[model samples]
Target: MNQPVSGFSKKSKAEKIEWLAENYLQNNLRSVQVLKNYWNDDPSLQQLHDDFIENTLSNYYLPFGIAPNFLINEKLYALPMVTEESSVVAAASNAAKFWLERGGFKAEVISTEKNGQIHFNFFGSEKVIEAFFEEIKPKLHSSIQAIEKNMKARGGGLLALSLVDKSHILEGYFHIHATFETLDAMGANFINTCLEQMAHTFEEEARNFEAFQKKVTYPEVVMSILSNYVPECLVRAEVSCNVEELTTKHHEGKHFAEKFVRAIEIAKTETRRAVTHNKGIMNGVDAVVLATGNDFRAVEAGVHAYAARNSYYSSLTHAKIEDDVFTFWIELPLAVGTVGGLTSLHPLTKLAFEILQKPDAKELMQILAVAGLAQNFAAIRSLVTTGIQKGHMKMHLMNILNQLHATEAEKEKAMEHFMKNTISHSAVVDFLGKLRL
Candidate 1:
């Protein structure tokens, strides 16, 4: 039987580990050792990691890799990627090199607007609430001035405040919808702070107002939070070249371009294919987002919402061929920050920024968008020509070798054999068996 324990967080790291091992792990020494093995060698670094979250045990690691020769907006970058997938880095690098010989990727930040809400329950007259909102709009901005001081000095802060009436849809539901521009920061904390302050001021001021005082209808402040759906904080990245430039090993340039456009059209019409197609794009976007220590989850949420913005989910990347030129591009809402949070805290995050030449928020947005575009191009290229599994299974060979517990000599022979032969689990196993015999 499991039991809840109080003061669990107050326990020391060793004590917490011991309790977990004893209670849940059945006192398995190997399990305990595995956790301990992942701890940082330096005590200070271990402490820093432990402080990052609650109930810290040991660090979970993902492979950090680099895809070089990415030419975005006439500048070169070696994009840092952190992922567990075997083929993502390789695919991104292939696309980067492919485009490098042509014109490279072009990227731009379309907007930088973020939003939040102060949700509340108001049972007052609709007319009264609307008039009150009009009166309190300026005060809402004034209340959060102290919080916005530094953000404004950097040319980023609260931009607009509006009252939204949702009482018709959901009884007594009203909100203060606020917009912000946080510049280089992701601005979650900043936007939420302003929202909460504005909410507090609204409630306090409403109590003193004559209509509210006479009628005793006080709006109940429910919550204040930032929205991850940042449709306005968008970036676009594209790669374009003459149709002749799209020639690959297996197909002529014009034929390849025709097949590629048709493939995108299928993804646009089919939900199942669109889901996987967009997921491939995120493989590149998320890798860079993680390496740079930005919020990949938030980026994912915003991007998927944008995909379904037209009442049906569809491909994030689009392909077109016209005037003897083939173009492939993606435009997505990515609200990621270059500073603050893990970017300044994690050592590798600092290194990632240095490798990127210290791009600002807009520059980082552009680079991330290009990463996604490159990844999609590689995936679609593979799908339209040689098929996806050939490369994917080849890249997955090491994982299979590790699972089979093959020796160094056996792995070397297996690698050589698979280079000339098709890779499959049964094939590898049979080869190993024959080698053993």
Candidate 2:
């Protein structure tokens, strides 16, 4: 029943945005079409649209919100995800519903842990710096040891250190990993500050090298950090529901689980299947990343690189039904932030963050982890039984017909559920009756 609207055609840009937000929340399904018109008039909206285009790298993008309708473990989240892959949004939304039908998702997050580095480069003179490197070693040892005195006193210390050369030069990089319990912070700024301190001290002490400019690589040291995104710290959500609630017809969940495992195995082992499979996982991860203003690109890099570690390039998650029950799970290498950078600059990102109720990074990561698992759950659940295209094509058809500018009759022809039929362009014309969206 969603029709293309023209009522806002006359409104100013700001008016349309205000109207779009209200109607979008109200579930007016054709808000996307309305958005195009609004974007034409509004500079701010255009900026958002442009940014999205750059971020997603696709001409096609869709945004939908996942509300934790049924919550478990006393947690509620409005998960927003954007992706073109079919079934992703529906799958995640459906999975969350499955959990919510019980008590809702219970999520426990480990404190955030950040690692910093100090890259030491011997620029001018190697001989002086070589002797100073030895002196600096003892100083570096004490400095590192003394840096986290209070943290060490609290039983968390500089976890470890590694020195690696950039190329042939003696450009050694100190790999510092500090595990902290950031109860509710993003820790990027905090971690960056910590790294800055080390870099400064390292620079000053490098003066002992005299002629050689032995300095700590500040920019490189803090460049792009690698997060300690332990999969265990992820939001683990479990649900229990009467079999009757899940389907119109009764299904033995255990059998479904077995099939799910096999499907996942196939998905991971096969190269083509794995692309779609991991893409399914990103359905959840990317959405949360977009909402949080985290770099989805970086997230994608880390996840894919990690996925390649075993040479098998396997799936990131697994699911099964056990003992008349259904359980779903996914593990992720998600490095996201709750503060700084894009989160602070983007308007929609700011609004989305507020909708999340300003959760600390730990809580935010939990939300993302759950979304990834939930999305994966949606994909495998369909593939094991109905097949992926069956459901996906349903939505795809609707979108295609809309784009084709089809009429009510042609739309109904495609919508007919009992029989599988294709509509020709001629048939579509016969059905056309001054159609609207």
Clashing pairs in 2: 70-100, 71-103, 71-104, 71-105, 72-103, 72-104, 72-105, 72-106
Give the Å shift of residue 310 in candidate 1: 1.1
Residue runs of model 1 more than 4 Å from their true location after superposition: none
lDDT of 1: 0.93
Estimated TM-score for each candidate: 0.98, 0.65
Using alpha carbons, what is the TM-score of model 1?
0.98
Tens-place lDDT per residue, model 2, 1-437, is: 34466765566655655565566546464654555543435656556655643222112335646545524357576776656655667777788877676556555554344455555433333344455555555455466555556556655444544443343534443333434433343445555555556566557765444445334322133343435443323344334444344553435555566677788778768878888788878877898787777878867876776666687787776555555565555556555777667777776688878877787676777777777767777777787777777677666666667877766777785578314644444444444544434
- Model 1 clashing-pair count: 0
In terms of lDDT, which candidate is strongest?
1
